[model samples]
Target: MATQPREESANMGKSTWLAFAVHILTASGALWALLAMVAAADRDWPMMFAWLGVALVVDGVDGPLARAANVTEKLPTWSGAALDFVIDYATYVLLPAFAIATAGLMSSPYNLIASGLVVVSGALYFAYEGMKLPDNCFRGFPVTWNMLVFVIFAFPGLQAYSLAIIVVFVALTFAPVRFVHPVRVKRLRPLTLAVAIVWLGSAFVAASDGMQAQGLTGIGLAGSSIYLLVIGALFQLSDRMRARSAE
Candidate 1:
């Protein structure tokens, strides 16, 4: 009789865990989608960028939260993972593409080709690397990097030149190089950490300073580009360090 009761209790615990896991995953997805939609409709570049930043911050926490809650261990196999990936791609890739198109970034034939290449390259890299498990290391430039590049170039006055720079960075994102996960700080190379800090710091400064610029487009563009380049270099160094440590 006691054994039966204990078994039932265990089952209930499992059900509760599963429910919590699903809720978290669903909430994360909804938040990302909502932000994306807001960005799409408002067409306010700063707001769009702010939302993306928020999404990134949320994403950084989800994994750890799930793990700490043991959600990954107890939740339905692949359900949470699948939903997470879908939401990620939607927020990171599809929405950005829509933003670019709606913003008329593709008005020119050259711009159109460049944008298409960005999409293709990013898609292929995602498809190839995303198939693996644990995702300890990324095989190509992360889409986040490319998306940041796009956001930087999307500024009003720098639109044309920024778009060109975006195309170049997109190509780099597809380049056959590994990018290290930021979570693995112990294995992070010095150069990678330095670059990452500089890049992120620059972004912070730019965002802060631009708030006072009123309508100065170049201010944000220049700051964001510097941030992206440093970020890229950090990714490269981190990836190399991670690969070496793993070996």
Candidate 2:
């Protein structure tokens, strides 16, 4: 009877470990999808954006899923942190830079100069702040905003305006602005979940339609962008308010 219980316990342990492995695999899969989307942007850039949107959705849930499965505690600290940073850099920085280059936005001499300046400035600012305030809040816009800019510009009708806006935002990313970081609250959890679902679903819808249909694409891109922008603003404001109260 003791042997039987021991065998069952062993099997349970194996199952738990397998569940953790699956979570890690899913996270890695999302990263690859993000990379693929950026690479595909050259030919059908909007389609790539759509895929990226889907990956973003997957990322939003992966953490919760891991926690629920009780696998988060089992992950090795170094391995997990390293993977997280890699995914973050790939999805936010490298991919957006690739998309900008592939879209030929930098072909014009003026645009080339502007793009180069924005990237260099952002890099220098990031390096300086990262080195100085290694543990504190970020000094500039997060690179994830680049994904938002890409999604906006990838749409057919919004293409022209989106390009202009993206250029401006690219500069802002390097600007000296202190964006707030809000705490996650229970009341806002539902709204956060809704945003993720809608944004990800819109991407799939846009991709299925080939992004050539201006009306549908416009709705999706605009809706997603507005949703994210509002959320970001709200989060920042809330964080600032909380900080003031604590002080």
lDDT of each: 0.58, 0.56
User: What is candidate 2's TM-score against the reference?
Assistant: 0.67
* Candidate 1: segments with Cα more than 4 A from true spot: 1-19, 22-27, 104-106, 130-135, 145-147, 150-158, 189-247
Q: 1-247, model 1: which lDDT tens digit per residue?
A: 8799999999879866765865575467657567757866877655555565556656656766666666655655646566666666666766666566666654766656655666676667566735332445554556764246444444445565756766766766756555554553334446544545444444444445542222343444455445434553565677689999999
Q: Which candidate achieves the best lDDT against the true structure?
A: 1
lDDT of 2 by residue, 83-200 (tens): 5455655555555555665565545664455445445645554455352222233445655644554664545455556457666666656655443222233436576556655655
Q: TM-score for each prediction?
A: 0.67, 0.67
Model 1 pairs in collision: none
Question: How does model 1 score by TM-score?
Answer: 0.67
Colliding pairs, model 2:
none
C-alpha lDDT of residue 158 in model 2: 52
